[model samples]
Target: MVATAETGVRRAAGTVPRPLRGTGIGWLFVTPFVVVFAVFWAGPLLVGLGMSFTDMRSTDVRNPLGVELVGLRNYLRLFDDELMRRAAVNTLVFVVTTLPLTIGLGLAAAVALNSGIARLPAAFFRLGYYLPYVTSIIGIAVAWRFLLDPEAGPVNQLLAAVGVDGPSWLADETLALPVIIVMTAWRSFGFDMIILLAALQGIPKELYEAAEVDGAGRWARFRWVTVPMLRPALLFCTVYSSIGFTQFMEEPLVMTRGGPAGATTSASLAIYNQFGSGNFGYAGAAATVLFTVIAALAFLQFRLGRSR
Candidate 1:
């Protein structure tokens, strides 16, 4: 029955209809993604983890002695092997060499982009920076190989024009790792720059205004306001770069093939060599070790970030 306003009475309040949310259609829509992730990501990760525990060679199921559990023997090999030690050293060198350039130059570019700079310069500069990243890795490697050739290369030719002889960029063991590091930095920093560009945009206008009111000079304002604000983003980028360094494979594979007397061989690339040569057990073990290192580094960074 309808209730009059004067009565201030109504039939018992009807149950509020529960809003229908997240229908089966939602799961149906995400099913493709779920399927792909399980197949490509989860499956391989599980397989790799299992492989890490076993002496699973490509040749057989690694059941030569009926049960092939090598325990930590394979993991121990990386520390004991001279070549693996060299690779680890080379990888560290690459990381240490490239980090400043990538982070510094990336932040600088981001700042420039944030500034109301001339549009044309900004566009072209961004393109020039990012082009190397999207371009084929092999193309970069091949171009660098020729450019750094001991003779008959434009880079050396320019040096000769200036009455200076360029050192063989990737030919000398002393120079090879450094060259790879530089090239990788060049190819990579653009992505970091764009990430930082977004982070710079996210900084509130009020922060700068507040700094200005405090009579903070540009550098001081940057140090106090901008840098402190950007720390979280910077930390994330650093961690990402560090992981990439751990997985350094392409530079040595194409440019040096872990050559120049193994100066540029990284743990990842060495593991790849093992897989290619049918030593999957060794590869798996090396991968497991590298994985542990990466996981630890990642956890450390996250802890540091949380503390910050």
Candidate 2:
């Protein structure tokens, strides 16, 4: 018994358990990702955070360490900047307009697909809807530019046939932001559709059948059964869509260039402009503020989702 115990003790001391051995291998495989993430994401975030508190500028590029720390001065400047206020309002408007439209269209598409549509037709619809998302933003923007061209585009041509002159959609300050919102919604709805579709598929048909058997009409079943079952998915889509809409830069940058008196200047586009103008520290502060807003909004969304 002593020999057996000693042998077991020696084995335990020399070799890891099976579970621990597997865990060690898993961590080894994950180490490369950890290193890369730390180097690329975490490192830059720390550097940028530090930069936000300084008076760094284009001239400081050659002597970064020589830049003076300005503490909260950069952040204070953000509040008094009329352009920043405009950008904030634009971003808010964009988020409010696009979030509902995108999620609504996506939910509608997902429900249509989850219904009794034939497999082949549904597959085709899925492909058509999702195609825009996988396509390059540059290509999408170019296509939108062509389609919305005031004199030469098909939309205006159709309007002209009805004896109505279509205005320059992207160049008019009043119309530019709305047009961008529509474009963004069209490009984004497909992603939400895919997510909602997966969730819809996972829902058991039994619950739906029971609702029907209880004499619930289509709308009733949808309101009670479908909507309740889809809450989690809807929450996820809402939060994800909110964050994306808040940071939307490419659409405005490419489509309208935040033009026509900056009607379409989103927060991110404003930050990009600051960076381009070599106000690195100011840009950094703006970026940090934007990041905080995003994080707070996300947290609020998650809290609401949990409550629901």
Candidate 3:
């Protein structure tokens, strides 16, 4: 009787009760992305993982079932390979060197852009800085090669005019990796600048005003107010740059071909070289190791960020 009375009251109030349905509408909106992810990402990852355990070659493509499962032998081989160790070292060097320069330069540029710049000029500078990020990396590498050419290139020409003879930049193992690092840092920092710039604009002006009123100098204000507030953005940039740099391949592949005595061969480039040389199982093993390292580093970064 009470329930009937409530239903009558609800009707009188122009409210109607409906049966609870499943989340069909929500799934309707999400199904496309789920399908795409399954087909592209999940499927390939499983295939690659399985391939790493088998002694599969490109020649076995016609009879994939005949390829022998080698267990962990392919992975074990990586430890004994001298070139693989060299590539691992080179990758580590690239990530460590490029990450700091990219982040520091980007943060500086973002602060410059956000501080007292007029709207029109700020927009112009923002676009200019961001162009390299959107530009094709291959094209950037090619242009960098031309500019750093020891002969006839404008950079070397200027050096010659100043009575300094330019050495073969890309041909020297000592110089090739450094040259690649500079190119990569210059090309990538603009992306970080844009991210940090957005974060800067979101910061409240009242915070700065308060710091100034407290007699905080510019450095004190930045170190205290700005750095603390930008922690999340900084964390994101660090993880993203770490992941991207771990897979560093294009710069070395295009600019130096990992040449001058394998000095610039990153782990990704090594994987590509192995695959090209028909060692598909070995390449798969290398790729799996690289993926594991990337995952571990990213997790560590997140853990450190969370602890702080």
Candidate 4:
């Protein structure tokens, strides 16, 4: 009788019985991550926002209860501060100069490696390019600092051997920021290359064959097929590189100390300087500004990518 009823029900429904819905037991595995994120990431972000509005000095570390709210005065003071202005400009310069170079070089390298013309194993080439990224940033900075040293560095020595005098890279105000930009591009392009290479590989070979059948030249094929297909990956690399360049601090700190008349002081380094000078509230305000800028840029990039 039970079989008969089940058959009748299925006949009436015109389909077999559906399985029971999941009870969401799978979420139990993700609970630990949620808890950790709330405690660490979300918790400190809220605390930092609160600190940005108060007169919090480094000495008040022992007594967080003593901080007095100063409203937006710390933020307002940013406009009148010359050093802050310079830092912001320097940061903008770094982003403007580094973003295109990094993306362009990365794309070029990815294309070259993908073409299989190098006669080396592709993984070997990828690992060689990505090695600097996994290496310590401090170590890279220190090594580059010595390599760019005016008197004894190999880079300048090579230039001298060619009968051309190289400028004091980190010591010259005019050249300090550019030197950092080059070093940063060299160390960071590998990640972009890997991402772009993946995007390139995912493009269907059939499209290229069709383009060829239509009598398109190599550049024409790449322009019509490769670029459009790789749009998402390119956008990701651009936005990621922008955020990294905006937050640049370590290289300048280690290599130039933001020196040569403060030519290389980035916004992040400015915040670090404020905190080092015991002005916690001021540092927090700078951080808040940086956060706003990054958020806005990311939103803009997302909109652009979606629209495209």
Candidate 5:
């Protein structure tokens, strides 16, 4: 009976499956990424955090072991720093103005292109809009500087043709920041437009047809159907543009250098100026504060997105 049972079991188990491999192999594949992240990203972050609590300066490079911990002194100084205050206000203004404009223009462009009004290939229009985003920032800044030149720029020249004198865009403190905001918005809207376009494409045509059959007009359908469907994309673009605007540096640095009485200075530019002046501790403190603000904003955006 035992022998018969054993033979029956062998017959039932014909072509036995191999045992599944363990997760050890998967860990091995991910080990390199983990190692690199720890060494580069995690390590630097920890060091920077430590540096923020101390009076670490560029001169300390000669005596790396002799740094003194001042315990919040750097952070306290930030409150009294007039330049930092100006930078913070400038950054806030940039965020308030640029975020809406970027998202609005992007959505408008996406809608127009998706509507097929240009009578050109969609790819051509898409590429044309996206070109500035891919181009180098320095190159764009240089071109814009020329275009915004009060005396020789084509923009001012065009204004002259119409007998409207263009302001000294980069020279006047009052207009400089606004000009930078506009330039930044133009360069950034392309990315948001592309993302929104993809989201728009993913929406089913039946939804629009259903709305039309239900007596929904163009604006009504857009408000009821389109906006709701595009909420996730819009949320992403808003949060992304918000963060970028808050941390604005390169444009102001290259274009204005925080000039015209530092009207265009941003938090990043302030940090850069501090770092350049060998006030490493102060810079790190400012950086940590900026990081906190960005993190808080991101958290709020996430909560809002989830709530909606």
Candidate 6:
């Protein structure tokens, strides 16, 4: 009765009123991320796209003269390079090899860990599997590089101890890429497994029980019930792993340094080398090719989702 303003009968047992400030606070909180993305991400992307049209190189900035715009010549040169072509093929093979192995093992691990069979400490087991992933990629590659040395590697030493002489893992071109593929699979699958395990837990157990009551065997139940429920998470892991495998550079760069005979140079590694070789224009063109390939892969994933 004595209030001037904003004084109504206090709510005794009713819902609290929402903030009249609306989304102002929310937008304010998100502004930092927006600004950072615009400056760092969008700014660099635009600059790189512009650099692609010019002869920008490591030493290009030292001179005051502006870079010359060579139109489509740089792009044409990339297509005409036989080494680039081989690099593309090698990259494709690596991706194809890495995706199935990583994603498949992840799915298997997720199922086991999420199932009733997980009697051990799941965190310890999960952390153990994830250890390699958390370890430095460069450090791991360096360690493995020594571990796969042609004449004096521990892997071969163990084989020699077992009366089976193992061939050089890194020096042998035939085995080098395969070894990297396996190493990458082992390191990456743990992340996917942890994510997929969380998704598996979200699925209702009643569905599985109902599935069991329907006379479905283990394999049948997994195929129809578990797999169907897991498709979304599976697709996510597949697309992520595919993109990662496709753009792999660190492994081959550190381990093989592009090969015993250029057998392990991924497209990313090639592009990186292009910069060092003062082929900035050509590198940009190849960068677009990688972007296009990744975009196509992402689009295909959407198509798969729609089909499902």
Candidate topping TM-score: 2
Each prediction's whole-model lDDT (CA): 0.81, 0.91, 0.90, 0.89, 0.90, 0.82
State how far residue 98 of model 6 sits from its true place (Å).
0.5
Better of 1 and 5 by TM-score: 5
lDDT of 5 by residue, 62-173 (tens): 8968899999999999999999999999999999999999899899999988885655677888888888989888999899999999998999999999999899989899
lDDT string for model 4 (264-297, tens) is 9999999999999999988888898999999899
lDDT at 152, model 1: 76
Q: Evaluate residue 289 in candidate 4 and report its C-alpha lDDT on the 0 to 100 scale.
A: 91
Q: List TM-scores for all candidates, in order.
A: 0.86, 0.91, 0.90, 0.88, 0.90, 0.87
lDDT assessment of candidate 6: 0.82
lDDT of 6 by residue, 39-134 (tens): 998887777777777777777767726678888887788888987987898899998888888988888888878877645687778889988989
Kindly report which residue stretches of model 1 are placed more than 4 angstroms away from their true locations once superposed. 1-27, 61-67
Clashes per model (N, Cα, C within 3 A)? 0, 0, 0, 0, 0, 0
- The regions of model 4 sitting more than 4 angstroms off are 1-27, 118-121
- For model 4, the local distance difference test gives 0.89
Where in model 3 is the C-alpha error above 4 Å? 1-21
lDDT of residue 188 for candidate 2: 86
Q: List the residue pairs that clash in candidate 6.
A: none
* Candidate 6 least-lDDT 10 residues: 1-10
Best by lDDT: 2
Please identify model 2 stretches exceeding 4 Å from their true place. 1-26
Model 4, residue 10: C-alpha shift (Å): 30
Model 3: how far is 5 from its true place, Å?
Answer: 45
